[model samples]
Target: MTIRPIVRYPDPRLALPAQPVTVFDDALRDLARDLLETMHAAPGIGITASHIGVSLRVVVLDLDPIDGARTYVNPEIIWASPEMIVHQEGSVSMPGVSDEVRRHARVRISYHDVDGNSHPEESEGLRAVCHQHEIDQLNGLFWIQRLSRLKRERLIKRFEKISRG
Candidate 1:
């Protein structure tokens, strides 16, 4: 598996919604492997196909090293709890910037595995946070947009400063 280059923030491609994965084939499996490699190399808990400029609805997450990586193709959040939870979120595309993001405390998502088999699972806490974050990426909504205008502006400024220095 190759570690693909992650598309950085402010890239117009990152703002566009991802296309759903229709075929479950070797290419899809390879892309999933590549995503896992790239996410692991980024040392990030989660990542999506859109993060690497691939507009496919795929996400890779590894919140627990002991359990290894998990791949999701055409993931869709079918249910979300009314209760909300806040978790510090970051993206491989954004690199150094991170902020708290509020989302449903629990979520049930339906997605396909590497072989295209459908699976639906419920998640909470950090797992739920990762799903929400990656799903937002798939929807073309950067995590920064979840912040207030003032906070978003400040964070962008800080990111620019860090990027320059």
Candidate 2:
């Protein structure tokens, strides 16, 4: 396992759609492991494959307190509760700032494991929100997109200033 470099914002790849994994090969498995390592090293709960310049529909999340990490390939949100909850969220790619946004309180996701076996699971609380956030990344969506127009503008400026430093 290795820590992969995170791609920062304003990178065109962040807006590019990710490709679906085709083969459950060794390389794919290694990428998932590396992603887990990278996420842990960042001390972040979630990471998307596009964040490392790999345009693949893969995401790794570690919301467990015991260092248990889960990798999802070709992840999709199968169901989301209508009830909404707002949480303060931030990203490693854009540090030192966070925003409050509303997201479904529960969700069910389906994805293939490293061995190519399909699985679906229900998640709630931070785990649910984190998974939804990462899945959004796979679809070229960022949390900032959920912000109001004014807030999004301010965040972009803040990130721009950070980038210039």
Candidate 3:
């Protein structure tokens, strides 16, 4: 597996919605493997196809090695609990800064494996947060958009300062 370069923030491609993965083949599998390697290199728990400039609706998440890595193709949040939770969120695209993001405490998502087999999963806690965060990226919604304007602005400034180094 190759560690693909991450598409950093402010790249217009990150603002565009990703296309659903329709073909389940070796190439798709390779993409998944590459994503896993890239995420590990980024030191992020979750990442999406768009993170690597691939406009496909694929997500790779490795929240814990004990649970193993999970690949979700065309993942969509089918259910979200009314309860909310705040978790610190960051992006491979925008490294060096993170802020608390409010999200559903629990969520049920429908997606397919790389082999095209459909599956439904219910997640809570950090897993649930990761699901929402990555799905939003797939939908062209950056995590900072969920923060207050002031927070978003401040975070961007900090990110800019870091980027200049």
Please report how far candidate 1 places residue 116 from its true position, in Å: 0.9
- Return the clash pairs for model 2, or none: none
Ranking by lDDT: 3, 1, 2
Model 2: ten consecutive residues of lowest lDDT: 89-98
- After superposition, candidate 1 runs with Cα above 4 Å error: none
Question: Model 1: per-residue lDDT, tens digit, 55-91?
Answer: 9999999878698889998889999999999988877
Greater-lDDT candidate between 2 and 3: 3
- Summarize candidate 3's per-residue lDDT along 48-154 as a digit string, tens digits: 99999999999999988798999999999999999999999999999999999999999999999999999999999999999999999999998999999999999
* Least well predicted 10-residue stretch by lDDT in candidate 3: 60-69
Assess candidate 3 and give its lDDT. Answer: 0.96
RMSD of each: 0.8, 1.3, 0.6
TM-score: model 3 vs. ground truth:
0.99
Per-residue lDDT of model 2, residues 86-124, tens digit only: 988877677666798789999999999999999998999
Instruction: Give candidate 2's TM-score.
Output: 0.94
Descending-TM-score candidate ranking: 3, 1, 2
Report how far off residue 101 is in candidate 2 (Å): 1.5
Residue pairs in collision within model 3: none
